[model samples]
Target: MPKADAESPQAPVDPRLLRYASASRGFFVAIAAIALAQTVVIVAFAWLLTRAITSAIDGMPVAELAPTLGWLAAVVAVRAALLWAREAVAARAAARVQTQLRSALVAAVGALGPEWLAARGSASLAITAGRGLDALEAYFGRYLPQLVQTVVATPLILVVMWWQDWISGLTVLLTLPLIPVFMVLIGLATRSVQQRQWQTLQHLASRFADTVQGLSTLKVFGRQHRAAASVERVTDQYRRETMRVLRVSFLSGFTLEFLASISVAIVAVSIGFRLIDGALTLAVGLFVLLLAPEAYLPLRQVGVQFHAAAEGVAATEDVFAVLDAARASKGSAAGSADSHSPVPEPHPAVPELVEGRLVVRDLRVHRGGGMLPPLSFSARPGTVTLLEGPSGAGKSSVFAALRGAAAFDGTAELGGADVRALAPSQWLAWAGQQPGLLAGTIAGNVTLGDPAPDTAAVSRALDLACAQALDPALELGVQGAGLSGGQAQRVAVARAIYRHLRGLAPVVALDEPSSALDAQTEARLWRGIRSLADEGATVLLISHRTSARAIADTVVHLEPSEVPA
Candidate 1:
């Protein structure tokens, strides 16, 4: 399940939103200032139009009326300019906020590491970081400004209305609450449905991405048609959820419109009767009547904009949850540091185990809320230590624990330091079961993370990894698509070798590096692994092939362990 799968419709503006995306804070202040100016302009425009109309009716000379008319026109233009300014500010602010939130989200995910992300599908996260943040434009640009307008304009308009005509002011005051009452009721329904709609969209994206990624396997098993049907089903469900959101939005719009119209009508009718009965002056009556709709307008709009912003609000909940998690993780680390807490080792080590040796004693790695059975081994400088095991025997889990992706109990030390105390990049040059290659020249891929890549060393690393046939200049597509699996695997090994040989890392850990190679290539790769050990580099090799035994200086076999219930 998603972490922030629920929606909160209560707060008009989430405080956490401003905290995580600091770009939006100044935007609110700017929008508030603009809203204040707009409220003043709205009143000026109404008063000038009233003055111009009353003067013309009294048959005032054309020359005298010209000034009022000119002022009215000027006020109209200023109001138009203010609207343009608000939109410009909102657009720019929205863009800045989106960029900030996306950056924070990506960094947070990196800090959390791949082990935390394994439970969350990449498709859902992509949607959140991409389309999810994009929807904030409506919230930041349109809905938020209108909401501020409502906050600043509505009450001020009502106070002006009361000064001019108390009866009309009171009439508006009585009916205005109806709109929000309906809004609250309708917003409750909209929040639930919009949340579901957002979740369904995530589900659809995950379904489509999963199908495309595994299309080859589906075809091999003759289940491609079934996978297509599953994607279509999810797509249809998303469409239905979208339609439901639209219906609620339309309903909310109709409700607010109906209530606002009726409220304005009530105020208008009362004003007209007062004028006919000689209870009100013409100037005041006209001014308050014009001001009546303006008073209710912002509230009605607030109700409407609330629905428009609902989806964005939902997205923010998820974005904020991720950010909050990052903050908590940082705080925990800080707390641990203050309390003199580093990852503790389970036993008092033999003093001789301090330097150069990669030693593990009774290490149990975490696996989905359970622990793998304890195992222990060591690899010294200039030796290939093989971790051999069957499927589900926790071989890769051991590598994961070393790299900070999985938590483990017990001690693993290298070069006189705890593995947990050092950054993985400082000590381990690792390649996992997956090639994990990005789109780039093979040279760039091999020399990844190197500040100044050595051209000569790139070639040597390729040769050492038995990837000499692959050119350094060869370019590949996303995930190294141009190369065959064996070629990509060799390139991954070369990356580890390049890092190690450059003295950038100490332990070269390879997981199933020859899984895709033929017997001939496998033999050559084995020679390269042996050569690295011969050069006084510590090599941790994980492979199932019995052929791996010939090169191993020490073989530690992992026994099959069942996942705990």
Candidate 2:
């Protein structure tokens, strides 16, 4: 978790955040209006208090100053009320914008889909969306409102101070520039510190995720100790970086306060001299003295809160970068060969397709800056089709293209109609080589993303995929920890099988489904695959195993395309 240090120096707030704040314009307007009102009350309170004090010094009766004192009390009350309202409005605005920004980011990520997001690790993206956006709370609640006060109240108080005593006002004016100058000097250091801290935080999160995901593999290879050492090193680095940020924040805050206090002391001293010489009235001198500190207060707060909002600003930058990349990819894909291919007719809202004939004719897929050779295959309903290729043979690329994740040239059709025309979710039941187990119940992973999951169908699918060892109601830890690799793979198979059994999709596809299974479990899994094919569904499976080829009704072998030397 990122700590919010109120006194830390921060970088300038992004204008993009300001534009995002436009959504809560009314709340900010209320905040500004309330701040302006508070400024007026501050002036009145200072003037009244000075007058009451001055009257007493002039030997006026306490009773005679009662009404002036009463008005002073009333002004104090109004200022307090304005303060509360200003805080409330700022908090509300922060909550509103945080919600808006986070939702927009999540929606954009979903629109980009798994392929793009996978390229950028899920752990980093999760941190950006979760803790990153959460950091904005300080930006909105404290820093932003204080920013408004610095712009509105400080200047107004300064103007009142000027009207009361020009010399004191001139002194404040000359010294006022020092606060921001010192703030800027500190902010340069703060910005670099914050950037490093944020980067370290992201690195730590990514490393932890990677270590956890590969812990099994590490254990198998007798490298778990090495992985733990790496994790500890990363954790230590993060701790050091965090401490550095805190140190800088405290130092910057002390400097801002020292400068502000010095400026106030100078004003107080000058006013005292003027009063001893009888060059200034007691009321005016006292009023200027009181307002002097108030003039610098807002700027001081801004400098401090800037550091608190630093992490949020960095996180926002990362999220927008992801969204921008997604948009650029979509724009690029829109002009690619996939977009030019004939689009299939829109399927009905409810997926009612029970069976589909699969066809891939002269299909060339683009992936990772390379193109797969043109490939063709066909499978009738109630048949299992296998795609065979060695490593780097583009079998996975073909799967990605058929799944509509990769852009392609040529045609992929279902039942003589272009597969692109069919609703992707409605026509395809996909289980990738990676299990893709989420953090939830076994049943939940099995029925994931299904609009309406049926209990009987879920149970039957689980049984068919031979994942009965996992209790449907039992909660699984992150990434399905505690489950063996075969169990996880079977869980994914159950998910795909459930979708088809529920008639949500007609074409069931599995990528290397038997990779983790032993011969016995692999045989059972193949039976499930054959059963699905027998039930009038077109089945597509990718494999390099001879055993997989034995069960296939149709085999399509893709040779690695030659790259010229």
Candidate 3:
């Protein structure tokens, strides 16, 4: 994954987000239609209002000017309505884009798996996918539409100005370049500042989230104060960073507004000179002045909104970088031909291994700066196998390798074919060292992502994992917070068992399955686990406890491998 760095302020628009934006073409099309109608109304309103006012100044009778006044009123009313419709369209587009981008971001992160997510820090990812994407609302709703307006409206108004009087048009043309030049200079200077602000935001979010998640542990160890102090420090830093971004924002907005106001002033001065010399009529001078500000308005709004959108842009860059990393890692693992495919098909299934033994021959996993000594073992059908090892022995590494969560060298076979060649969905059900439960009902955790979760199967798995003690309807806090350690582990085990019971997979792997259980609960859990083996499913457990050996059909003891100099 890409490490946090000061991203270039001038980084190009992310193609991923652009692709998502493109998918909402209908929304933009509606917006464009409205903008076009609104632009025409604005120009007409200016011309009609000018004509009526000039006639009034010339002492035209009220009765005679009534028709012109009525036309102006009608134009103003249509312009107001179109303006409302344009805003409504922009809001709808913003919402659609935000929802689509957030969903895609989350799905991509999930497909990358736990190992990749952990490396990036979950809190940071959460904030990016949640709040960071939300910032795009300002971009989509305000900045982007105005940008389109500047493209469409500015030129149309400028042509009208030039047609009215060549002198006023010449003055506007000379000053128009100044607004963009100032905007560009200010953007270049503040891009890095905004990038840094976003990085600090992610860091603060990561620290705060980790602290909250581990609050109980910190309180038990009487270090909560220290954690609080650290949080406060980070929070202060974030505040300062936020202020810096605000300062830049205020500066940019002021600069763009000031430049635009001066440009309008210059146009006003030329129009006034022409009017005094009788070279221009009162109506024409007033029309040119009104249109002058309109021409610069869109460009000025773009500059202002661009600063607001900078943080979202930075977050977007980070999200795409993570996605790119995931793609690269997957590509490397699958090799060239099937590399880009997220999931490749296993080699044609061997019928003999379809429901047979899992065999390993010198299966060495590369991890922690060294290779684990070649492991040779066989897990027969209808047997429970325990992998016993000291801390740092690469036991979990080996387990992950067999499950295809990590890459390894040497052969691992089921029946007679290599394990890597077998479809993992056909055989593997894994419960990690910690219970990875979302905040939901116990039943929901047991059947996460199951299309049609069966209550009977859930109850059976709960009983088998000794987790029936937990009420099926009980709600767990985030990360299974409300449950005790043992209960949480049991719930995780139940999840694997639920999958097994549902016939999704036949082999179950539990990492430190009973580490939090008391002797009695541990025994009951293992007995339940062992029963699976007796019922013709392969069971693999990783543990360091000596008591686990008593129930295991085979115990393989491994010592930590030494790192080579």
Q: What is the descending TM-score order?
A: 1, 3, 2
lDDT of 1 by residue, 1-565 (tens): 2445344446888898788888888998999999999999999989998888888889999999988888888988999999999999999999999999999999999876666777687888889889888989899878899989999999999999988888888898889889889988998898888888989888899998778767767998999999999988988988998899899999899989988998888888888898899999889999998998898888888878887777888887788888888888778877887788766432333232212888899899988878998888888989999999788888999999988788889999886678876667777899988888889999999999999999988999999888898889998998888998889999999999999888877789999999999999999999999998999889999999999999999999876654344
Worst 10 residues of 1 by lDDT: 346-355
| Best of the candidates, TM-score | 1
**TM, every model:** 0.94, 0.90, 0.91
Candidate 3, after superposition: displacement of residue 238 in Å? Answer: 1.5
Residue pairs in clash, model 3: none
The residue-by-residue lDDT of candidate 3 on 182-246, one tens digit each, is 88888876777887777788888989988987887899999999999999998898899889889
* Candidate 2 lDDT by residue in tens digits, 219-295: 99999999899989988988998899899999999999999999999999998998899999888888899899899
The runs of at least 3 residues in candidate 3 whose Cα sits more than 4 Å from the true structure, single-residue gaps closed, are 1-15, 323-335, 338-354, 366-371, 415-426, 563-565
What lDDT score belongs to each candidate, Candidate 1 first? Answer: 0.86, 0.81, 0.79
lDDT (Cα, 0-100) at 55 in candidate 2: 90
Error of 1 at 497 (Å): 1.9
Q: Per-prediction count of colliding residue pairs?
A: 0, 3, 0
Task: Please provide the root mean square deviation of candidate 3 (C-alpha atoms, Å).
Answer: 3.1
Give the worst 10-residue stretch by lDDT in candidate 2: 1-10
Q: Is candidate 2 or candidate 3 better by TM-score?
A: 3
